[model samples]
Target: MHFGIRFYLLASLLIGAATATLYFFKGHLYSRAEPLPLEKLVLATPRIPFSSLVILAKHNNLFAKHGLEVQLEITATGKEALEMTLAGKADIAAVATLPLAYIVTRSAQPRILAVIAKSNYEHSVVARRDRGISQPADLQDKTIGFLPGTSAQFYLEALLTNANLARNKVHMKSITIQDSQSALLSGDVDAVALFAPWDKRAAQALGESGIVFAPSLHTTHWTLTSNQNFPITRPRVAEKLLLALLDALTLIGENHEASLDILAQEMEMSRADLDESWEQYTFDVQLPQALITTLERELLWIRSHGNVPSGELTPVAPLPDFLDYLSFSALQSVKPSAVRITR
Candidate 1:
């Protein structure tokens, strides 16, 4: 009887062990076989330093961590990126408030997702000292090159206004920001108002002859924007993207040098240039009250300069309700504290 009892206990132990082992392996196999699929998202952004957060998110795989597979569509300028988003080629676009303000006037399809970064020194006037343009007042009668219907023109005009120079005093040349450096070097224009790192490149190209003038025009806000229906249709996707960017912002705040390395590589810029200009930008995710104020201010500039073609809007037509163009629900749901807009 004692031998039988001992044998029975041993068999029971063996069965229990086998069952436990089988259960563990079964669960492991199930996990391996049916892994969760990542949602695909397309982000259109300009290949500029302003897009550092998006680049970091892509490099670090933060989007995947949040269950998103983000594909980047790089453009030469924010205007182009915004256009792509408007045309349905991309789901999101990284753009500045100037372009956002101008585009919304013609079409109300675009909506602001978040203001990712702001910089007081993003726009500047790089001129050759040989052109007798050492001071802001010297810009008078000098041919200043700028991209029409962009922040470049807005900055140039604001700089002149701050200097008490009239708009007609300076001859404005319509040169693309990409061509600003060559235009300046080839003497196509005495000075070029551009955004970084083009402004930095123009300054470096001129060496001792280069003089960079940064007037206190307005703070340029770099924003992530989408179509009017995107956030409503795919709220989870929008929230996930913002969460990924929030992670990127945290990483940037913690590891400055490492963040700069990622940005430098992504932008194809030297580490030194990126480092030098890094301090000028405040990287964060916020929908500030200033966004509305800035849009209102820029709209006035847009109307006065006739930046938009008359065919798009009649002269007497009231300005767009900037508030209507903003979509705050996604950011609010992800991080309520970050949404500073009153409405």
Candidate 2:
């Protein structure tokens, strides 16, 4: 009877131990799982110089680190991507300032979250070897192809106006980047406004014939626009995204050579072109006072000049909208070691 009792006790002990082990492992597995507030975010991007972050985020798994599952969709135009956010099809969009400004003017009030990339007026009006274009003024009476209704178009127009060329003097064709190269080479268009990799490629293809005319003024803002309601509805998600973007922006500035290499791979451009492009780009994360002033001035100019209808130039409301959108709290929470606020 004692032997049978001993055997029962041994069996019970083993069963108990197994149950305890299972319970401990189950807790561990739960701990390893993603946090309760995980989010799935969709970000829209256009093919341009500022697309570095989109490329890096996926490759480096930065989003996953923050419990975010991100989907990046490359759209035909920045305007269309911005529209996706407005229509509730996208969670965030990395695009130019003009379209966001236009959307803001229309009363949708998409908030500017961060400045992704800024070019130092290096954008040029390039022409084919046969076009014989020398300056912005030469663009007059010539068919110039650009992304119409984009910041590039607006800036190019401003450049032409400053150079004594009127809008009526030039024939404008709305073209995409893929087609701009062929259009200029085939004599279908006289000139195209190209940035970075395209600029280098155009220069090589047309040789001395490719004339580059720098825009008269600088575009200091390449910004991100997001739906206001998203932040309100999903504050955690918005905060996480903004934090990740700022982190990415800072990385780009600190390690430009590496950043350019990443951008080159993403755009499928030669490193030499990427280097040339990097020289013209200013990757700044902080919204400087000068940049703010320039943006405000741009809004005023766009209104006064009728570049966009006056109703479309309505002042950016919820000053704190920008403030909240850039809140670094989530980033701070995730990686406090990365951010150093120096006095």
Candidate 3:
């Protein structure tokens, strides 16, 4: 009986060892296909609430599966993030294309790899109900508060200019976005130029106290820009980033309510306001020629403001034709079934 017990014990040990070996090799086969270095790649982001989708994607391990380490830095504004990238202080900046395009126009080095989103009716000029402000044309000769060098500023300016109103017609004051809320609430400024989360907050604080000018202007929202000087640059990385974003975009569109819940939590806003904002906003990932037209309009304004001399320097770098930036190949690589929420 003792000999039989000893033989049984020996068989059990061999089986256990073989099982462990198989498990280890199987994991290796799966993971070793692309073994990345231990270090992580950092990406700069803004604290804006709409940015929750990108933040959640990182927390949910979507980036890790693609052999990437995405680190998020809460920046004051997208322009600040672009500054970091231009200074070689950050790996990637996720923000408005206006600032990034401005930077590239000033110095033709940083190449915009992919667009995060195209701006919709997000940027708006809001006023308290008491102010009786009804439209963009109404903003003329009034004190319009804006954070200069921001996408909001660009939109506001475009709206005003399109209305045949020059910058001098309105009393414009440059204020930080955080301060714009109080500035409007306290009647410090006649009107505040801002985007959602802020717009929702402002409207709620002063009921009927807010009005938005629709069909004013829209531009590229967030774009991923990389140093053209990076040694290991690859179009493939740009493609991957777009795919990840498109995945999140698909999820947001299909499950708007659930996505808004996520946005509220990430943005620290109430569910009611998030729903309100969502009703007015649209997020589409496809790049259209309208972006180039917007860029040309922006560059013309930049020249008018003497921000960049028209004759001395071109306002924008010669980018891949509008279609080139649209990576159909990248979109094709991501199986529709991988992130499809409905269709």
Candidate 4:
């Protein structure tokens, strides 16, 4: 019986030792099986079709596929998105050429990562027929409403230029996108210069009375921009973001139906409505020389105005080299062909 007791005790010790060793190995194995935490990024963008690529990236989990946890901060306009980025509220922002140029003229701290999309007819002027604005030429002596400091204002000016109308001939009213329809339907303004989908909404609201005038002046480049230090400090994050967007672009190019579905849901619009303006957008990841030309043209406009819509005139500074505002290394690293800028 004593011999039997000794054997049982020895068995119990061996079992305990085995159990401890198993647990030790199990802990290490479990740790090795765990996934590395994804890097977090905040992308600020307007809820428009121009931002379809980023939206699709989030919806399709491409960002996660690239090991990023992207949080989208939807803004009413690209101007707001850029402001959020400049204020450190977002890591990146999708903005238009106008606002980007306007801000770049003031400060060189905003860096352009890539031009994701461009549309020439995305902006339009919706005028009230009753306001005697049958044509763009009639816009003179009319009060026009637009979202200040946005591409809306720039496009409005372009429309006027196309019409041979003086900028001072028409009264420009500052309005928000939410107020555009009411402000127009109520006769608060004679016309509104707006970007899609607001432009479409305003036109539909007016029915037979609204006349839509496409700017067709210059292509509006929808771009991804960030604070100057963001890419410099987080190069990998920036590269991953571009990679994810490239995936989204491929999806957009390869499967139009699926992409349309994603964009419609993201923009909270019916597929039909999205389809109407679908052809206007050319979604791609590019850094073209046209971007620089557009910026320079907008800078000339800003300089001529002497003051942005924000407030009184300050003496404008000389144009900074726009190339300085564009960070090509990230795009060059991801897809060399996409970086078509001269410098």
Best by lDDT: 4
The digit string of per-residue lDDT tens for model 4 on 1-343 reads 9999999999999999999999999999999899979999999998898999999999999999998999999999999999999999999999998888777766648999999999988899999998887889999999999888898888898889899998889898899989999999999999999998888888999999999998578789999999999989999999999999999988988998988997898788889999988999898888998999998988888888764866735437888799888888888899999989886
**Judged by TM-score, which candidate is best?**
4
Tens digits of per-residue lDDT for model 1, 62-178:
999999999999887888888899999999999998888777766557889999999988999999899997899999999999876677778988999999999889898887767
Q: Considering lDDT, which of the candidate structures 1 and 2 is the better prediction for this target?
A: 1
Tens digit per residue, CA lDDT, model 2, 265-328: 7777888777765667666444444445555555565665566532344344432223333333
Candidate 3: TM-score?
0.74
User: For residues 1-343, what per-residue lDDT tens digits would candidate 3 score against the true structure?
Assistant: 9999999999999999999999999998889776666335667878665465576567556666565667787787888887787787887777776665565556546655445555477777777656656776777778888876677888787788778998888898878878988998899988888876787677677676577675636654566666664424544555556566666776776876777777777777888876665655445444444655665566666656744322355444443233322233343455433222111
Where is the poorest 10-residue window by lDDT in model 2? 318-327
User: How well does candidate 1 score on lDDT at residue 17?
Assistant: 99
Ranking by lDDT: 4, 1, 2, 3
Flag the better candidate by TM-score, 2 or 4: 4
lDDT of each: 0.88, 0.68, 0.66, 0.90
Worst 10-residue lDDT window for candidate 1 reads: 308-317
Overall local distance difference test of candidate 3: 0.66
Q: RMSD for each model, in Å, please?
A: 4.9, 5.9, 7.5, 5.3
Worst 10 residues of 3 by lDDT: 334-343
